[model samples]
Target chain A: MTDDEVIHMEHVWTRFGENLVHRDISLSLGRGQILGVVGASGCGKTVLMREMIGLQTPTQGQVWLLGESLAEADARRKQQLRNRCGVLFQGGALFSALSVFDNIAFPLRELKTLDEELIARLVCMKLAMVGLGETDALLMPAELSGGMVKRAALARALIMEPEVLFLDEPTSGLDPVLGEEFVGLLGQLHRELGFTVVMVTHDLDTLSDLCTCVAVLAGQQLVSYGTLDDAIACAHPFARDFFHGKRAQRILGRSD
Target chain B: MLASQSSAETSALPPLSPPEFAVEDGTAVVHGHWNLRGLIAASPDLRERLCRAARRPDLEWDLRGVNVLDSAGAFVLWQAWGERLPERISLRHEQQSAFRRWQTGGIPAVRDGRRPPVPIRRRIIAAIAGLGSHLLAVLALLGQLILDLAHLARHPADIPWREISATIHETGGRALGITALVGFLIGVVVSYLSSLQLKTFGAQVYIVNILGMSIIRELGPLLAAILVAGRSGSSMTARIGVMRVTQELDALAAMGISQSLRLILPKVVALVVALPLLVVWTDVVALAGGAVSAHLELEIGYHQFFQKLPAAVPVANFAIGLGKAAVFGLFVALIACHYGLRIEPNTESLGNETTNSVVVSITLVILIDAVFAILFRGVGIR
Candidate 1:
């Protein structure tokens, strides 16, 4: 874990009773990079994401995010850390009772630094940033299609313009067309926003088109971490099977 | 890297961020972090920068030597470009996507206008429409249940005995502790108050009459029904609501399983059988509390109290109370299942339906009890 790195996990072990989700896992992410975390089911991908964002404390290791130790921080210090990051859960997890506008504006309102006018403008800007029109803001999460919900969640995630963004399965449940578009949107946001992203996903097209690096969690550890090609070439069985399998070949054959 | 930078006396070093412009005469030099913090720092200068850049004749822009550029920074530059990209900007290969996003970003030009705030009349109409659909669903469910019951009536051995037993264990067995505790408390309070009044008239023994009639004829069934409604009724709603939310109900329909017979009927039948017994148990527990109070306040022995209880309230009131318990139990389960089936695929609706089920069940129990009282006014009152 280097000082300038945006997120660093040093021997993180997330354990619940006898089950060790992550065992002595170490990884680091630099600023302005998008890292895709992929694994087979039950590989603790979400748990690792939760650890990076200070939501889950590592059972026996340190999690450093944006130059501060997340697990060791006080509440005020943690709030400062939290302010620099945004996380989108798998289900969009939008407050179902709130309108899309209010959901996007929630973090801004919580900061209490921006006026209502600026908040409204920024909310609209965020909605537009994720390809949502102005009129989509008034609708509830329940009214949105699955793809729209993901985009709306992405907008809310970006509303704060966080330094580090964590998206859990950003493209899952979307159609091929929408998935492609969403990945394109992500790549655009990564460039313009300059945020270090950690996304737990299973979509190969997303990794191919957008991820600057990939991390594979297997055997209860970060079996490999490097560029997508590096991961594909790595000899770890899980990594090899994940990135060089028949399905991967079909996907890679089609992408730029 | 920064820490390793040597302190220099003669610094002819390159500018950290001195973004040059093709049309230097008019095009503004964009510099520094384009991140959230950078935009926040530069927000105070937005108007001055935008106005000055807009008034300039030339609009050609360049981004070389810029330390960092983010969406927030790109947005500021776009604003300076009059909210549209110029013919060209000197963007590095890596910055191409960022620039494209800025050029295309903002509220879409064409949009369906937001609907006006729903008027009160329209909201009311919508609510009524929702209610109409819900009522229709409930009616359909009732029909399915009746059909299932008819089928079972034809095949007496086809009763879902396992599920009925489990429901009884859950709704009836698990709930006995709380019911007994609450019933005993209510009994003690009533006996204490009535005993005080009766003692004032030197008619202390009459406390048995007051406690017996009220406990058996009214309080016992109501108390048990309310307890069951809060305890079991809420669980039933939550269980079915989850089944709906998770599409388990749909899966059952797809599998050709009779949900009414397999799911709804067992709950109703279990409650119908268990609730009357619970009411009797509550009556016994509550009368025990009253007898204790009677012993304390009036020096009446337990035997005397038990012997007088039958004469004081009569067996007919007990039978009437059990009948009410059955009806209350059936209605509570129906109401709970109705709300459960209505749950949407959201946590908010689960909570809302659970609350509605409990409230509606308890309210219906009281309403039905009131109707029973009026309808059978002279039947149970000796």
Candidate 2:
């Protein structure tokens, strides 16, 4: 099971002082699969994503990325594993000081293995793939619109060609047009690049279209985990309300 | 905790195989893990080797024996061959799919890393414009503060003394201990040093004049101002900067609340009130410290030092110190609030502005003190 898993979390609990954000949570993501994480506000979906990426660690239990336990991997192993994955933090955490091109080239430069010439070309290609023009590369993060910032962040996340990509709330603040366009881009990149993606999001269209599986977090535990249809059919109260909610029903084109 | 974070304790690159190449009969044979993991270890050697290989008439990616190939590995291999199927090559199902993705998808081709450079003159002009805009906005905020103060004076009941007093308690009252500690320490060092020089001249009695004039008039207010600038001033800028980044300031503005009255005015008023009092407190503590040090070093009793201090340093010097403290306090708070309000909606701006607030205010305090020293030259020379 561990050999085939890209991400695996077991009995994970995250507590800030006295408040427990997650409890008794366990889940696994298969290789080459898209897993959409969803929950109500404050339910710790993003916390789970952070744990998998080693940005956050659980107070109890384990988080394994690409089959190596993050808590156990040595520095060298962790660095190797990190190079195999990418993360798009909430609000597109691009460095405000660097230009868009520099932000995208950041990981390549850090790897210390690639020449500037190759890094530049890779940055340009990523910009093009994310629907941004070459000219946009010179603009700073502050200069870009929200959608453009997200796209530029996405391009930066992809520059390394990681085997796994994790996104936190990829479409929350985007307008509907850009939201749809982003989902389309995600699908296209996932297919073309053949990387596993774990997105923490509440967007219904993304859940239905881009995700191969949906994991619902609620009441300090994973309430539901499966395909979108499985979530809609789940008996848990929050899962039922979420899938059969008026907005979700309208988006899914279902009467009940 | 990844490499991109840079703050991670692990700074060394992981050892992985850089792609290896060999020349064979005017052909290049490439082999190794160019997979998701191996590509992270791409070094100058691999690039140079690849570049040299690209010149070969026939290049072959003998992938039949190699393992660990992914998009990154395949992409680099494709790039080495100039994004085309090589003149002669080997075949495998996984390797074929990797190359096919490159053919069909977006991959950056190799090229010189160069961007059209901006002329130095243009950069300098842009920088000057930015600085000019910042200064102008700060002047505008100063005008708004004056108007708010006038309005509050006319309608005294509308003043938010509750918030203003609370801010004073938090920023000023809590700062007393550290201020006293540092001020006393500074006084001790100054007196001890003066005693050394006075002893050499056998004029130990004049230590009273030196300590009294410097601590009461110059060092006390300057020390207090610098301490507050570091402690309270940075905190004020950081608090307001965070409010801007989180859009709490926007929420206040949206509800038609006057930010000047509800936010900026209280901070400015609190500092203006707290600072002069703090300077007085600092002066008293420093004098006591100097008297104690003088007694220990010069065997001149506290009674003698205290008696001589009044005649040596005039009350006019103390008044000048008070005046400088008030002005310094006002400028520090105003500069802090100006930078805080100007913080862009980003985390980077919050840190940058907080640093600027403390640094710029401290520099201005010294400059202003120099101007005061020149203007009051005759008054404090008793």
Candidate 3:
């Protein structure tokens, strides 16, 4: 793997009992690129993403992240690798027992170096960046609205200033306006920090608006992986149907 | 400049330099990577140096040599400079935005001003008020339960038999093993201790009277109720609390379903039906345990102990135990459902309410047992 390659998978196979999810899937994501993985429901998009992040082991083959082989890394080395990446799960999995402030402060507190005062300042800055205020900090995760929960989860994800971020359906539950705002915030942060992003999304707007590269998964493999236009022009039946479908046509056409 | 320094290494990037600042000729020159990792690696010393440099009234800041600056680094500098930019400073173009973002959006205050401690008198008053509110809420729940029962009585077809059966299996069938173990052990202990005393007074034959009266009329129902309250009551509260957290209760309401009828009534009905049977099972097991211990310690035959139990304790006592068991079951179910409905949509509240449900149910069960003892004082005892 190249030094700039943030994620690399070769001949990765995922099988659940008798069902095969991925067959000989090989893909690589470079530094500072937003790569969107799109596929139909139950097509192993989440499983594939989970495999890339070392959360799940593929039945066969290898996956490397940030020049470290996931299969070869020990627990401590794996922990160090995990520190450099962030993930925003589909359900905004904030610690329900903690307030928003503590939730965002959790990762930094684990470092055991920074003082509470500095941590608080940093947490406040992140909350501001994500369009939350001081009052929102004291509220529990269960008290937050759907949009607020997403924002809070995003703040926690970016707390460590990770080199890479993995988002699972970042804008799925949000309305269009909130979704657009979230995509805008994501794009701005990406430009400023220049971190790599690997996102699994079904929203065409998110895929078209923020993704620098698109990978289409169908028929148990990566059918297309390239620029948006390259993915749209792919001759694969699933890829064509996905990119040239009515919803995709309207959204992609507007973007053009 | 540090980017070039990092790129100069071909195979692996050199370790990042921690943020450092030096006051050179009336200018505070700051350099190195000002990111989270770099700052953390040099936290205590770097923070002191930055604060000390920030204290100089005449020092101009120069940050042109810094290669990286994230929000954390920006925050450290922002805080050290007294939450504002230094009057005279030079920053690299890329690094300027990090500081600028903070300027445009005013820094949010982290700590709310210190809250004064409540006065002692007010604290007591607040405690009393909280108790009053809880009492009222419990009463309100009981009212709703009565209305639900009336509705079910009128519309027998709408009664939730399936849910009631499921709850019975959960609370009654699953609890038999634990209740039997505890009841048998208590029975054995009481019988053995009483036999030792009776042997001293030459009253060993009266062990049957002691064991039968206590186990049948009091200990049997009390032990079963307490165990069920601790085991099933907490679970019921947690189940409803989680439903509240996930907004499932609201969903049910939106679909025009009565929560009390569906959720609360089933548990109440099931416990009422189940606890009496459990008490009977516990009474029989405990009496058998007592008989075994009596035979061993006092040399009384099993046939003699069994034959004397009926004549020793009247049938009125058995009826009273069953009645007390039914009452305890009713209250335990009511208290569990009460706390379950009162839970707020948060995990901390869920935990607190579940604990309260078990504790309150057990306490109420004991209190009701005392009331029954006074009310039925002359009926069962010889």
Candidate 4:
């Protein structure tokens, strides 16, 4: 894989006992592209994302993230690679024991080099970037509302200035207004930082607004992987139904 | 500058250069990768350099050669420049946005230094207040349980049989192996020790009396109570604590289900029914162990030992042991549920409450055993 390809999967096959999730899937995500993975329920969108991040290994084939083979990297090398990327889990997944300020500072503190003052300043900047104020920093994750949780988690993700970010259902639980605001924030950050994003999302609004490219997963294979119009024009029945549905039509139609 | 090149060129980029500054011709020339990684690698010396440069008011700043300045790098530069942009700094067009962010989003206030240690007088007063609140809460929980029992009495159909059965299996049925092992070992140890003492006094036969009274009346009930308190009490509290964390308890309340009846009552009933039986089971195994030990040590046959046990230790002692076991079970379950219900919706609180439940229940068990000993002092002994 070339250096510009931030993530590359080669002939990956995932199986659980007798069940097959992914079969001979190959894809490459270039740097600075927001690629959204979409599929019907139980079609392994999450499992595919997991494989990309090296959380789960495929039964066959190799996955390379940031030009290093995930299967070949040792523990320390894996940790270094992990430090270069950030993941926002479906649930906010903030450490419950830590307050918002500490959660954002966690990655910085792990470096063991940044002074507390610099770490604090960076955390505040990130919180403000994500539209949270300084006063909200002391609140624990459990006390945060759903929208604030997402914003706080986003702040934590971006604290390290990661080269790439992986998001699982970034706007799943938010109301329409908040979801839109989150998408706007994400887009603004993307423009400013130019980091690659690989997100698994079911929301049509999120896919259309944030994703530069979409990969449609179906029938244990990548049926279509391209721009929105390309995905819609594919001959696969799942892709047709996905992009031509009434809701998809309304959203994509308005965007066009 | 090599760090900013696009990755399309297959040549690997040079390793990040640690941020540095050199005063040349009365201007501070800053260059290299000024991002988090480079800044961290050279943090101490770099910060010292920045601070020394900041002190030189006459020096014009040159930052046009700096590569990849992130928010962290910007914040460091901002702090060194007295929380504002330097008037004489040269910057690249793209580098201006990082500073623009700082201008729009004003500097955050630094946290004050460490808090003062609390005074002893205030600490004592706070402790007393905390104790008072805990006592009140425990009493309120007991009152609610009483009311729940009264309600269940009025409408027997509302009883949660499945929950009770589940608790029974979890707390009692699954605990058989460990309790049996411990009981038998303790029995052998106690019997052997007593036989040693009796042999010294030419009173080997009295081993039966000592083992019967102590195992049946005291050790059996206390052992079972302590074991169950550590095992089941913590688990009960953790289960309810997690339910509270996930808002499952609130969901049940919204569905019009009484938490006391459905959750607390089943545990209380299960422990009350289960503990006495466990005590009895422990007592029998202990006696068998004692019989074997006596046979080996004192040459007392198993038949003689069993035959003499009932005659030596009266029936009232057995009754008192069972009664204590029942009371210990009730208190253990109640205390566990009380702490469980008190947990806040956070993992820290869940962990703290579960630990507190186990500790407090075990302490309560010992305290209640003392009270039982005092109240039933004259009845259970000869």
Which has the greatest lDDT? 3
lDDT of 3 by residue, A1-256 (tens): 5668888888999999999999999989999999999998999999998998899999998887887678877798778778888999998999888889899999999999887887887788888888999888888888899999999999999999999999999998999999999999999999888899999998999988999999999989899999998898888998888888888888888332
Candidate maximizing DockQ: 3
Model 2 regions more than 4 Å off? A13-18, B1-31, B40-71, B87-135, B196-204, B346-348
Clashes of each: 1, 2, 0, 0
Q: DockQ of candidate 3?
A: 0.42
For all the predictions, what are the DockQ values?
Answer: 0.30, 0.40, 0.42, 0.35
Better candidate number, 1 or 4, judged by lDDT: 4
- What are the clashing pairs of model 4? none
lDDT (CA) per prediction: 0.82, 0.83, 0.89, 0.88
Q: After best superposition, candidate 2 residue A242: deviation in angstroms?
A: 1.4
Q: Which number leads on TM-score? A: 4
Question: Model 1, residue B357: what's the lDDT?
Answer: 94
Residue B200 deviation, candidate 4, in Å? 3.1
| lDDT, model 3, position B315 | 99
- How displaced is residue B225 in candidate 4, in Å? 0.9
For residues A1-256, could you state the per-residue lDDT of candidate 1 as single tens digits? 4545888778788889999788899888898889999998999999899889898888898777776666556788788678778888999999887888888888878866445655666677777778888767888888899999998899888887788899999999999999999999889777666788999999999998888999998889888899988888778898878877889989888332
Give the TM-scores of the predictions, in the order they appear. Answer: 0.86, 0.88, 0.91, 0.92
Model 2 lDDT tens row, B1-382: 3223322322433335756667777646566666645665555477657756776755555667555666567667777677777767776766787677558765444243346789999999999998898789878888999999899989999899998999888767998998899989988999999999999999999998999899989999999999999998898898888898788998999999998899888988888888888999999899889888989999999999999989999899999999999898888888888889888876678888999999999999999999999999999795
Second chain only: TM-score per model?
Answer: 0.84, 0.81, 0.89, 0.91
**lDDT per residue, candidate 1, B127-224, as tens digits?**
99988987797788778889999999999788999999999999889889999999999999999999988888999888889999999999999999
Q: Tens-digit lDDT track for model 4 on A1-256? A: 5568899888999999999999999999999999999999999999999998899999998888887777777788778788888899989899988988888899999998877888888888888889888678888888899999999999999999999999999999999999999999999999888899999998889988889899999999999888977787888888888888888889888332
Calculate candidate 4's fnat. Answer: 0.31
Poorest 10 consecutive residues by lDDT, candidate 4 chain A:
A247-256
